[model samples]
Target: MSEVALLLQKQVSKGSWVNDKKVALIVSGVVLAMMVAFLIVPILSILSRSFAVSDGFGLENYINTLGTSRIWELGLNSVVMASLAASIAVSLAYAYAYALQRTDLPFKGILRIVIMVPLFAPSLVQAQGLIFLLGRNGVFNRFLGFDIDIYGFWGVTLANSLYTFPYAFLILSAALAVSDARLYESAVVMGAKPFRIFRTVTLPSTRYGIFAAIFVAFSLSITDFGNAVVIGGNFNVLATEIYNKVIGQGQFGLGAVVGVMLLMPAVISKLLEKQISKRQHAQVTDQSTPLQIRPNRLRNLVFGSYAWTIAAIFLSVPLIVFVASIVKLWPYNMAFSLKHYAFDVQNGTAPLWNSVGVAFATAFLGVVVVASAAIVSAKFKTVLSGPISFLSILPASIPGMVLGLGYVLAFNNPSNPFNMLYGTFPLIVLLYIYYNHAQGFLISSTSLKQISSTFDEASTMLGGSTLRTLFKVTLPLIWPTLLGVGVFFFMRAMVSLSAVIFLITPQTQVAAVSVLQLSDRGAANQAAAFSVCIMLIVIAMLLVVRLVLWLAGAKNVTLIR
Candidate 1:
């Protein structure tokens, strides 16, 4: 061959090599585009409407909304309430995680499992349980001859702490699990005091996790509307206020203004969490060994007590709801009955079925979408990968109520292309997946990142197409994570409130929303029944998943260990 021709041939071969990965690029583009259409554009539209005025886009709406003293009061209320809740939750979660991870606490497995009970149930269920326990005419209150109020700030704060405790515990436990035992051993050899060692070594090591938990807890607490709406009577937080403005009064402009304000703190917290997560990954290296605590009598006793107390509190909500679900009536009858389960009042169990349908659709669709996007973004790192990854985790920071409001404004418009999805079933499914996509993406991407890149290179060299390799190699390797993602989606979708609350129509009512409505109308027992049904569905689904995994010879996969 001529020299020029040889050079051209080499360049063409290199171009062909680059072109071979166009499948990844195309998948990345499609995922990113879907994210923009569903997540990004709706958020932008809501933000833009915050500045909309009669003539054109301006600050008049913001001025009108923020100039009111009520707005400032609501903002202050949210900050104070969320800060208090986050502090309590993080403190409890840290101690619980520490006991489970660092100490040889008794019943550690049971404690760990019980601590996650709050995660499966809706926050409203917790609030209602609290009401049944401590509200006016409550069983404990009346039995003890005391009148305690479970309303306003304290109620909301406590319920929020309960609702967000598991999130913090997960982060903190993961942090504690991967610590370097050598540090503690060296401290022991140097004769460092226990408190000193904990302060200097343990605290410093898990600081990123501590901060991440704090931010995640605070963000979740402030943005939550279910607990606030149920327990925060006459105590308005920013989230409930936004719901009132947007849904109650049809003041989209005002709601958008508050949502825009809520967005600022949430976005900052999310960035901080992202940074902390990145820092947390470096805490353990190949040389790190698992820390095993030698039990000290007094220390073990104290830690075990702490763990038990926290677990009891975490389990109380669901337990109380379970009892309430079977009761004929509260404080009056006190007789057990299954009439509430009949759900004869509101469409007679149809809502629960609809919820199941929504949850199933969300699980299937969520796993597919999040897994594909995660694999592409994690493995390929294409030009659009960064934005795609950001979009995946963006929902963690955005409040469900705000996202729902955005959907209402964006898709409900006559001029919008998605108007057909305004009150449809598919829109709810999309919202469910989008709202809970972050956890799925994080789990899947983390799993994918652990598998070495050599596998992909080898697969390509062996002439396997990218899709073929993904289905045959990558999918099987990360199948456990995918299963976890499905369960996560289904559980969240079934228990979810804020995201699909506004989107649910009379014809498409969901169980969780029905619980809210039932509680609102003073049918606390029926609400509890619905909550129990939701929990039962989640537990059944989990069991089925585990059974399937075992039957398939994948006995090691756990939904959440």
Candidate 2:
């Protein structure tokens, strides 16, 4: 009887394992189908369009695009500007992150928040603010009696650097936050100097992070359209060339060719990033002691000054933007006025409301999509796991403008089942979700990775199914992270410019696009005012989410992820 009972128990365990695997396969299949439909099909459609010729599909478009000396000039400009911006942003962000994570600086929270200002507003806001401060008739030229010109290459480079700074800071901060105290102690015992220890021990540990930050900043700078359009003037890059080709000249083939070219650098950088990350060893082990920040007066003072200076530069952009928005006239008059806030541009304030609605929708649906992808990829061990994981993070390598162009190419055709969604708000929301999917997926996966798999095993042993364990155990533990992901999607949908630019119809114009239009038609103050509204909405959203987290007894949880 004892042997029979033991055999029966073994059979029951095997049954549970089979049930769990089946469920994982189903979930993985569903997620993979969605990614292929929404992500893969669109990208392929655009690539096909690039090869389409008058007679049939051919390489005529690529040959023509590459043969142009103008195209080569734009490509060189993009590579050079992107390289400079990425270097500047990464170098500054490294110092800023080091100050926050390793030093005993006061008001580190405020300094950190200050650097994130660029993330709150549209990317063009940096260029707009620079114009207000240093344009031909800007504050410096008009009031400070200095000749200044904020346009063309240097202007766009500076704007891109400021725009990409926060992203780098986030990656570097995470890298510096973890260190094994034992390594530092051993170095000190060997009588290594501080700089030598930093060069040998600190730098090597965070090398992966530095590479990651460089990749992010480089990708952002190279693909950015907002800053280049606003401040580039005659200095065009590949991003603007794509816009001019498709939107201005109505040449989808040429635009598609540019889009394909844009993918090359991003793909190469992503491949290199993967190789570098594979070489990084685990920094924190079971027996590792966390490195503690020791207070040093000179160290604090030096880093404090450096951090605040960077913070002040970051703060000044939005500050001047607010000042410009309310002033009667930017450089001619200093009197206060609310005329710009009236939003006299096309569609008045409808775009702002439209963006709010879209942001809410994106937040709700994005949480479901990204959370599902994360749960399936992280929790399941299925044959589909490798493909699902690869596709989920693949969007990070594709530029926003390229993805937006792909959406146009893929869904605009009448034969496509998703054609009805082409010009609608739902389509725009989907674009925003997938355009920013990789980041949200990463955040969710990181959170899910922290929760032990022992809970799943225990639940299975007690006769719980995979779905039951997910809801009864996993969701309860990671719901806060899901909330953070929701907030992230909300913020992104609110402020994003490039991806949605191609998707918006006249009726579905979002606030970010409105800012672009206003700036384009030379309504600089109105653009500034529109930007202020977007920033306020983002801040309000953050506060509301924080309040909800506080009420839920998860007060320590950050909404930014």
Q: Rate the local accuracy (lDDT) of all candidates.
A: 0.86, 0.90
Error of 1 at 471 (Å): 2.1
lDDT of 1 by residue, 1-561 (tens): 244443543454655435547978888888988898899988988988898888999999888988899999999999999999999999999998998888887777788888888767777887988888888867679778887888999999999999999989998998888778889999999999999999999999989889989999999989888898888888989988888887799899989999888888888988877876775557678888877678788888898888888888778778878888887888788898999888888688999999999999999999999998898888766888888887888888888888888888899889888889888899999999998888889888888988876777666555555577688899989987798889989999999898888788899899989999998889898999999988889889888998888888888765863
Instruction: Name the runs in model 2 displaced over 4 angstroms.
Output: 1-24
CA error at residue 211 for candidate 2, angstroms: 1.4
Question: Whose lDDT is greatest here?
Answer: 2
Error of 1 at 402 (Å): 0.9
TM-score of 1: 0.94
Cα lDDT tens digits, model 2, 483-558, are 9999999999999999878888898999999999888988888899999999999999998888988899988776
Sequence-dependent TM-score of model 2 = 0.95
Candidate 2 structure lDDT = 0.90
Which ranges of candidate 1 are over 4 A from the true structure?
1-19, 276-281
